[model samples]
Target chain A: MSIGIIGAGQLGRMMALAGYPLGLRFTFLDKSKDTPGAQVGDIVLGDFMQAEDIRRLAGEVELLTYDVENVPVQALREAAGDTPVHPAPAILEAAQDRLDEKQAFARHGIETAPYRPVDSKEALETAIEALGMPAVLKRRRLGYDGRGQHFIRAAADIETAWEALKGAPLILEGFVDFDREVSLIGVRNRSGETAFYPLSENSHEDGILRLSVAPAGQPALQSEAETQLKALMEDHGYAGILTVEYFEKDGRLIANEMAPRVHNSGHWTIEGAATSQFENHLRGILDLPLGSTRPRGHAAMINCLGRMPALEPVIRFADTHYHDYGKSPRPRRKLGHITVVRDDRASLDAVITELMPLIKAAEGGE
Target chain B: MSIGIIGAGQLGRMMALAGYPLGLRFTFLDKSKDTPGAQVGDIVLGDFMQAEDIRRLAGEVELLTYDVENVPVQALREAAGDTPVHPAPAILEAAQDRLDEKQAFARHGIETAPYRPVDSKEALETAIEALGMPAVLKRRRLGYDGRGQHFIRAAADIETAWEALKGAPLILEGFVDFDREVSLIGVRNRSGETAFYPLSENSHEDGILRLSVAPAGQPALQSEAETQLKALMEDHGYAGILTVEYFEKDGRLIANEMAPRVHNSGHWTIEGAATSQFENHLRGILDLPLGSTRPRGHAAMINCLGRMPALEPVIRFADTHYHDYGKSPRPRRKLGHITVVRDDRASLDAVITELMPLIKAAEGGE
Candidate 1:
């Protein structure tokens, strides 16, 4: 069977890699043949935003999925006429906008920071007054990695923040005084068979994910996160991997956002878990039996941003695995990642401490 | 960097899968585009036996390797003029003929079954008398999986066995009444750094490999096997994975044959070991630091001969990994394989018992 992926990024490339062993082929829809996915699978050169282009790809494959979240939901719904698109386009519609996402979470009884929709400067000031002084104003759509969002620390900064993100659908959320950030990845099949991986504690630098360590968070928190994710998947009638990021404050999880796709925080599962998220996503979407989400060991994943460190120094560590997406270097680009699997969390932390400086040095340039 | 593989078989396909994470690209040389390797990487449509075709592939990549064993050594040597072909063409020459392989093993203090070269029918009968009534006559070259060989049970069967295999250069060997069969896989880099995986106990049906369970032999036996493998690699100045099958009789190892490339017995390493054989082969050939060969758990790999069982039933067991080479069904053809990893050998055996019947039934043309 062949699967058509809407975006040819590293995620799609990994999905193809994971799917190939199950006797599945992949065709990627993207503008360039030089992408990471194109290097491994057939390429259908087209724009993800165009329904006709998506239809061209949908015509050739048995199922459709996307590695990128920015694809237009209407285009996907129209293009995927007869073929199935997993996670459903409706879920994408909800995940694309902040207000809709928070509403979905609320509907599922998941807790989130206080928020109110803001469309005008008058509404922004009113939302700030109602929510409190410390808040964040974010565009409702197409915001990721700290983009299209601004923080308001005081009343004086509220107008400046409004000025910066004006003329777009916006949401004002009360600032979360988070102690730690973590995420839970779950997979559900069409039959409603679901499996959830242990929480991964994530660290970010300038809003870009820098490090992730798996099997983090307390068991109570883990179970709570899984229950919330299951409820969300059930609500959406979802089939595929779903990731929810949470802010932990005083032993409680405040849901921040959800991505209806395989996530970067779960990348360590490639070697640390019994089955990886990419493979489970394919299995769940294809309606096969979901694999075990058991962690094999403690694992840490370090993202190599802007530039990748030399392969020799990284792989020299025992049980270390290197991943290079075959991408050219550009400032702040996610060129590759390194994963280290250890028997215990302390050993994992020790190695990460020694490994971080080398990776951080390379991010400056080469 | 790109590597050119001489044959687009399952081995080459797996090598590409392992190399991709390390940011390597592959181009393969084969007559048919409908091969396991071609499904994942670019294909150079040509015959592996033709020197000119190999030269075309060698010209396109920085490094060269082969998955199939029958490639003409002269062709590889001539084609890979400057571009390094790992395991070295010289090692391939030594491994191609059974007599030369045995001689090379003996030089490294590796014991083998007693054998004598034969030319004519008269010579075959004379050798049979010297070796004994219960013996085996095998062609000296291009023989595998019980092909090109005949068994001599008694005096009446001697002439018949000679008549069956008389036309080729042959060897009559004293049959090994072995207790069990096992293989040791070892890797050497260009810098002569060496690593060895634990021995895998193997089972065969009609001389075709059916099952392999790794971390099987005693620690003393593993050390002995490693020493022998190191000597053989040092003698040849070899780089890349080398496998040697052994007949374990009364706790002693009798060398059988050697393959100068990645072997099937090591497939369990893909999930069972800290680092897989395919990745290690690439790291070795590329002159990178060799990965740790620590076994993660007890693992059993069952070859899916003739046909593959349904993915649903096979993958129902937790920690089970399925690999389908996408080959058409043929009687006794190696089509795919399933690997089961468990925390203990008893658990591994239990899963195999349940999995075997399903796979065997599929081989009957399901």
Candidate 2:
């Protein structure tokens, strides 16, 4: 059966590549006629907000899902009548708005940091007072890769942070003294069967993900987080891959945000897991039995941004796995990722250590 | 850089797929527009026998190669001036003719079943008298998958065997009392660096490959064959993936024939090896450093032809791996393959044992 994806970026391209081998064809939609996914998929080029394009995409495929969450919800809702949209428009609506998402988590008895909605000067003042200094002020909708968010360390920085947010619907979240950022990437099928991958500790730089190490060092913390994440997915009747980002503080896991589609943090699964998140997402949307989520080994993923430097050194290492996403090079743009899987964390760490030099060399660093 | 592949079959499609993540693009030449590879690649539709199409394809890419070896030698020669045709026309010339291939092997001190070229009735009589009854007669050129050959069990069957060859250039060979059929697939670069995958034992039915098991059961036997295969390839300065089919009889490995590109028997590498044969083939032609041929575990590959079967059983088994080549279904056409890797022979055997029932179910058998 054919499945239409709403974005033709690298995520869509990867999903298309993964789905094709499973007898699932992909039809991709994007405003750019030559998006990366379009290079390898049956593509329909049009604006995401265009009703005619959404209708055409819905008519052509057995089901509909998206590569990114920025597609207009109203357009998706209209097409949902023709083809089932997994994780549903409601999930995207909640995920799109930071305040709504936090509320959803709170309603489900899922732990999240203290937060207050702020859309105007009065709300901003009230939120700053309630959440206190050292809070994170973020745009309510469509923030990704560390964009559209600011850290407020002092009361004096409130006005500047507010102006940066620019009257967009916003949320001011109380900062948690967390030790690490971990994520739970899992899939729930229509039959209510859920499969969770091992928890991964994510590291970011300049607001973009730098790396994700799977079976994230703390086993008990990872297990506790997965239990809560799966329950939250079941509560929503979510039927697709979901990634819950969280902060681990004093052995307690607190929700930060969620991605309704395959998350960047789970890219290690391509070589490290028995079944990749991309493949599982296809299986979930197709209503097929979910494949295994077992990690093949301890895994670490490093993002390749802009241009991939010389891969010779990484290729020289026995355990380093390279996956170039085939997107055009641009500054700070994620072009691909590398996954290194090994029997122990020590080996995984060694691979990452070895890769640092290669990555630097590729960046034209001495 | 882009490479032009003469055919858009599964091999070419796989080559294109492997090429993409490495910054290599491909333009395909096939009679049919939008063939499987063409769906994800640029297509230049034309007959291989036509010079104009060859010229067009040559102009578009940096190098040229074939998915199948049947492309006319003259066409390849003409394309050579624009972009080098790898494995070279010399290799193809020897490989296409049974007599020439055997003679070349003999000159290299490679062992083979006793054989002689036969053209006329007088020559056929001399060949049979020398090679004896119960020999096989095979048409020399354009034969594959068990076609264009006949077995003579007795003197009475000689005339019938000759008739079956239909006046094509042919060969007569003494029957081999082989215990098993095995093959060695390897790649040689222009710099003369070579890497070889462990020998694989292949099982066939009706001249079509059914399965290939890597690190084939007998270690000593495989090592001996690998050494010989490497020596032969080095002698020819062969580059790209070369597969040499062999027969093991009385503890002796005898050369059978060779294919100049990635062979079906190496399909297990996609999921079972450090780097797939397809990826290495691209690396070899592009003059990149060769990759490791280390098998992850004992790997067994099963061919799926005509229709893709229900994958529930295979998916349920933890060790089983599936790959669908994404080809259109036609009677007796190869659609895809599955590879299973396991820690031991018992687990590997279990997957194979379970696979038969699944295949039968897919074929509508009880």
Candidate 3:
């Protein structure tokens, strides 16, 4: 069977690679003719917002999905009329808008940070009063990876934050003091079979993910977070991979955000888990039996960004594994990632500890 | 740097897939334009034996290798002058000719089945008198998977065997009462570092490989066999994947034959080993440090031949992994394989035990 995916980026390319072994073909729709996924996919080059592109993609595939959520919800709904779109357009709509997402979590009895919708100057004034100073003002829709968001650390910063938002629909969220961030990635098939990968502790620098350690550091917190995420997916009848970002503070896990598709933090699954998140996503979408989720070992994944040439030392480590995404070396571009899996947490920690030094050496040689 | 492979069959396709995460690009040369590997590779279509095609491929790649040994050596030599054809022409020549291979083994003090060269009727008579009846007649070159060989069971069978292999250079050998069959797959780099995968106990039906169980059944015998094979590779300065077939009888390992490229029996390494044989082969040929040969777990690999729809049951088992080669369906064609890996040998045995019932079910469905 064939699958249609919107946004032909690295995620779609990886999905295509994972799906090939299962006898599934993928057709990717994108605005650019040479998007990363198009390198190994059947491409339909047209605007993602255009009805004709959506129609063409839906006509050729047995199922429909997305690599990114920026596609217009109307376009997805129209395409869903022909082929089944897993996770549904409603889920995408809720996820795309920060205000709607937070409200939805509250409705489901999930814990989330305090937030208030701010669509105009008057709304911002009322939200600031209730939320107090030192809050984050973010565009309600289309914000990702810390983009389209600004922190209001003082009373003097509120007006600047409002102006920086460029008159977009926005939300003001009260800051939550948390110790560390983690994520739970799970997959559910059409038959209601759910599989959860071990939770991963994530670290980010300047808002871009830097490292992820799987089976997270805290076992009780990981299990509790996974159980909570799986319960949410089950309640929604979600079919496909679901990633729930969370914060741990004083031994309590708080929901931070959710992604209906595969997330970057789960990349270590490619080498550490019995089945990768990408492969599990395909299996879920295809209504196939889910593979094992048990991890092969403790794994640490480090993202390769900017002009880093960290391949030499990474390649020298017996346990270190490199995965180059085959993209041009643009600044801050995610060219690849290195995953090192070992029997103990200490071994994995040792690899992560040396990541910076190795990257520096590779950069120096280049 | 990029490498060019001369066939887009499963071997070349697998090599390309393995190379993907390593940031290695491959250009595949094949007659079929839409070979499986072509979906993810740069394909150059033309006759592999043509001088112009060889020259173009050589110009496009930094290194050259063949996915199969059938590639005409003369064309390769002309295209890759000092570029290094891994396993080299000398290795291929020895492997291609049975008489030459046996002589070389003898020269190296390796034990092999008793055999004699036969180029004419007089030579055949001399061979028969020396080897006795209940022997086999085989063409000296261009034989694979049971092709180009026949058994001479009785006096009447001699005429038929001779008629079958009339005009080709041949060898006659007395049969050995082997208890089982095994193979050792190893890699050697230019730096003289050698890595050997655990021995695989193989089972065949009509000379076609049916199954391979890694770490074999006899650990001590397997280890001894691997030691012998490693010595042979080091002695030859071999710099790629090598498969050596052996016969075990009365607790003794006897050399049967050898192939200087990736072999079907080593397919389990994809899921069982820390690094796959295909990736190691590339690392070896590139003179990079050899990867760890540690097996992740006990693994059983079963080849899928003909149009059997056995994927469902095999996938149902939690540990079972599948690989489909995407070849046109034929009665006895090897389209893919399934690998099952587990923490212990008992679990592997249990998986294989479950496999028998599923194979029977598939046959009944057919």
Candidate 4:
């Protein structure tokens, strides 16, 4: 069976790599044939945002899914026709806007930082006064990797934040003094079979993910997160992978944002877990039996931003795997990643520390 | 960089899959685009035996390698001009014939069954008389999986065995039947670095491999096999995976044959070891540092002959990985394989016992 992927980025490439062993083929829809996905699979040369292109791809495959979250939901709904689109267009619509996403979390009783929609300067003032002095003003749609948002620290900065993000649908959220960030990656099929990988503790620098370590959250926190995700998935009648990024403060998880796709935080599952998230995502979308999500070892995945480290230096370490996305070097791009698995967390941390210098040196050299 | 593979079978398909993560591309030369390797990589549609086709592929890629054993060594040597070929054509030339292979093994101090070249009926009789009653006559070239051979049990069977194999260049050998079979997979790089996976105990039915269990032999046996393989690789200045199959009789290993590429017995290394043989093969030929060959857990790889079992039923077992080569079903043809990894050997055995019936039932249905 062939799967049609709307956006042919590295995620689609990895998915194709994982799905091939299961005897599945992939066709990718993107503007250019020079993408990571296009390198490994058939390409449909067209824009993913265009309804006509999506329909063409949908017509060629048994099912449709996507890599990028910015795809227009209305186009997807209209183009999918009889072909099933996993993670459903309805959920994509909610995930596209911040206010809608928060409301969806509220309906499931999932806690989030207090927020209010702001459409005008007067509304922004009202939201800031009600929430607190420290708040964030963000464009409600198309924000990712810390872009399209500004921080409001004092009364003087409210206008500055507004002036920066004006003329767009916006949201004001109360500032969260988060202890750490973690993400839960879960999958559900049409048959109602659900499975989840252990929560991964993530660290970010300058709005982009820098590192992730798996099996980080407490057992209670993991179960609580799973319960929350399960309710949300059932509500959307979801299939395929769903990821929710959360902030942990005072032993509680505060909802931050969610993505209806395979996540960077779960990349360690490729070698750390019994089954990879990419393979599970395919299985979930096809309504095949869910694979075991048990952890194989303590794993740490570090993202290679802007430039990838030399392959020879990185692979010299034992149990270390390097992934180059077959992409050209660009500043702050999701160029590639390196994963290291160890018998214990201490060893994993030690290796990550030793390897970080080599990775940083490459970034500096570039 | 792109690597050119001569024959696009399951081994080449697997090599391409493993190399993708290392930021490498592949171009395969084969008769049809419907092959397993062609499904995942670019294909140069041509016959592997044709020198002109091999030259065309060599001109397109940086280096070349072969998947099938019968690649006509003279053609490879002539066609691969300036483009390096791993496991050099010299090794291929020796491995193509049984007599040359036995002589090569002896040169490395590797012991093998007593054998003699047989041309006429009188020569066959003399060989059988010297070797005694249970003996075998095998064609010197292009024989595999129990094909092109006949067994001679007594005097009456001598003429029958000679008649069956008389037309081709042949060899008569004493059969070793005391114990189980095992194979050692080893790799060496141009930089003279070498690594070896633990010996795998294998089982065969009708001279075809049915199952392989890794980390099977004693430490002494493993070290001895590794030493023997190291000597052979050093002699050849090999730069890729090389496998040596043995007949273990009364705790001593008798060399049966050797393959100049990755062996089926090493398939368990895909998940059971820290790095798969396929990936290591790429690293070796590229002269990059070889990966760790440490076994992660007890692993058993079962070949799916003629037909593949249902994906859902096979993946339901935790730690089980399914690999379908996307080949059309043919009687006794190797279609795909399933690998199951466990924390211990006993549990691994138990799961294999449970999974066999399901796998066999599919073959029967087909």
Clashing pairs in 3: none
Docking class of 3: medium
lDDT by residue for model 2 (B219-333), tens: 7876776677677677888779998899888878889998889999998887788788998898787677888888887899888766777766666677566666667667667
User: Model 1, residue B279: displacement in angstroms?
Assistant: 0.3
- List the candidate 1 regions with Cα displacement exceeding 4 Å: none
The TM-score of predicted model 3 comes to 0.96
Model 3 residue A268 distance off true place after TM-score fit, in angstroms: 0.8
Q: Local error of candidate 2 at A57, Å?
A: 1.7
Ranked by DockQ, the better of candidates 1 and 3 is 1
Question: In model 3, what lDDT does residue B183 have?
Answer: 90
Task: Please estimate how well model 3 matches the true structure, expressed as its whole-model Cα lDDT.
Answer: 0.82
lDDT of 4 by residue, B1-366 (tens): 889999999999999999999999999999898999999999999989999999999999999988999999889999999999998999988999999999999998898999989999999989988998698899999999999999999899987888788889999989888599999999999999999999999999898999999989899999899999999999999999999999999999999999999889999999899999999999999999999999988999999999999999999898899999999998889988999999999999999999999998999896
List residue ranges in candidate 2 displaced over 4 A: A364-366, B364-366
Clashes of 2: 1
Real A-B contacts recovered, model 4: 0.84
**How would you encode candidate 1's per-residue C-alpha lDDT over B1-366 as one tens digit per residue?**
999999999999999999999999999999888899999999999999999999999999999999998889988899888999998989899888888988998888899998989899888778877888688989988898889988988888878887888788898888999999999999999999999999999999998999999999999999999999999998888899999999999999999999999999999999999999999999999999999999988999999999888899999999999999978888899988999999999999999999999999989855
For every model in order, the fraction of real contacts preserved is 0.87, 0.38, 0.56, 0.84
DockQ of 2: 0.52
The 0-to-1 C-alpha lDDT of every candidate, in the order given, reads 0.93, 0.82, 0.82, 0.94
Worst 10-residue stretch by lDDT in candidate 1 chain B? B124-133
| Per-residue alpha-carbon lDDT of candidate 1 for residues A305-343, written as tens digits (9 for 90 to 100) | 998899889999999999999899998888889999999
Q: In candidate 2, residue A339 scores what lDDT? A: 79
- Better TM-score candidate (1, 3): 1
